[model samples]
Target: MEVTPRRAGMVALLALLPVLAFGIFRTWWAGAITLINVLIIAVSLYLLMSPTEEEAHEAHADNGVENASDEAL
Candidate 1:
């Protein structure tokens, strides 16, 4: 499992969405904040489904350890 750079970037943006919305709501307007929240949620869903590099590395490491253990046994 690995996330493309684009997907990672999108995930980061989604994670920051709530903070951006709060700032906008406080200083500028509510409607813009609401729209931003909706967009963030949608993007977040996509990011949540995307595979990450950490997951891939962990999986590879797990498999390697398992193979090593089997060989020792």
Candidate 2:
């Protein structure tokens, strides 16, 4: 459920690819569409690749609970 620093870095790099491509090869409208496409792709990739909510909850439940309780204090 936890994202390693290396994996986070890789995802960040992948998300920036569209911007880089746009800067290198497109005009205004094309760049805008490409940027939107990139965001969709990044979100899709994250959703597809990330662990399920149950898994994340199980992995971080203790920390999550503590944080929630702290917020109410």
Candidate 3:
């Protein structure tokens, strides 16, 4: 079965919690570092895993708007 990027990201995020918890238990400094790293990973995952459908839809919508503008003129 193909795992969607979204599912992969969610799994990764869920897995991150235990590691973060460990860091927090060790020291606040470690937790803060872990959090920063986690944030970076999350952002990267978000950007990389964004659905292609949205990009296609936005491109289509832009053309649609242009067509509508032309029609109005």
Candidate 4:
């Protein structure tokens, strides 16, 4: 299944809850867990902010490639 940004954010939130709990409980592994959470949050933010693959670049929108193919044809 494709994970949309919203889905990803939700997943990140779920993953973060345990880290937060560990942080609250002051577990030795809390720091490591929190670091991973940080990475997840960063990736979630990136996915949310950046355009999707389909929208990243206009497909067949660049004239350069089209021009080359047209010449060959």
Candidate whose lDDT is highest: 3
Could you give the candidate ranking by lDDT, starting with the highest?
3, 2, 4, 1
On TM-score, the stronger of 2 and 3 is: 3
For model 4, how does the per-residue alpha-carbon lDDT over 4-71 read when each residue is reduced to its tens digit? 66666666666666667777779767657786867777686757765767765665476555566578
Top TM-score: which candidate number?
A: 3
For model 4 the TM-score comes to 0.44
Candidate 4 Cα outliers beyond 4 Å, as residue runs:
27-36, 39-45, 48-54, 59-73
lDDT of 2 by residue, 17-68 (tens): 7686785787767777777777776666666667788988778766535565
Model 1 C-alpha lDDT per residue in residues 1-73, reported as the tens digit of each score: 6776566657656646676667666765664666577667757766777668898877777843456557888
Decreasing TM-score order of the candidates: 3, 2, 4, 1
For candidate 3, lDDT tens digit of each residue in 1-73? 7766777677668757876787867987877778778767877786687768878787777843456657889
Cα deviation of 8, candidate 3, in Å:
2.3
User: Which regions of candidate 2 fall more than 4 Å away from where they truly are?
Assistant: 1-25, 57-73
In angstroms, give how far residue 13 of model 2 lies from its true place.
4.5
Backbone clash count, each prediction separately: 0, 0, 0, 0
> After TM-score superposition, what is the CA distance of residue 67 in candidate 2 from its true location, in Å?
28
Q: Which ten residues in a row are the worst by lDDT in model 2?
A: 4-13
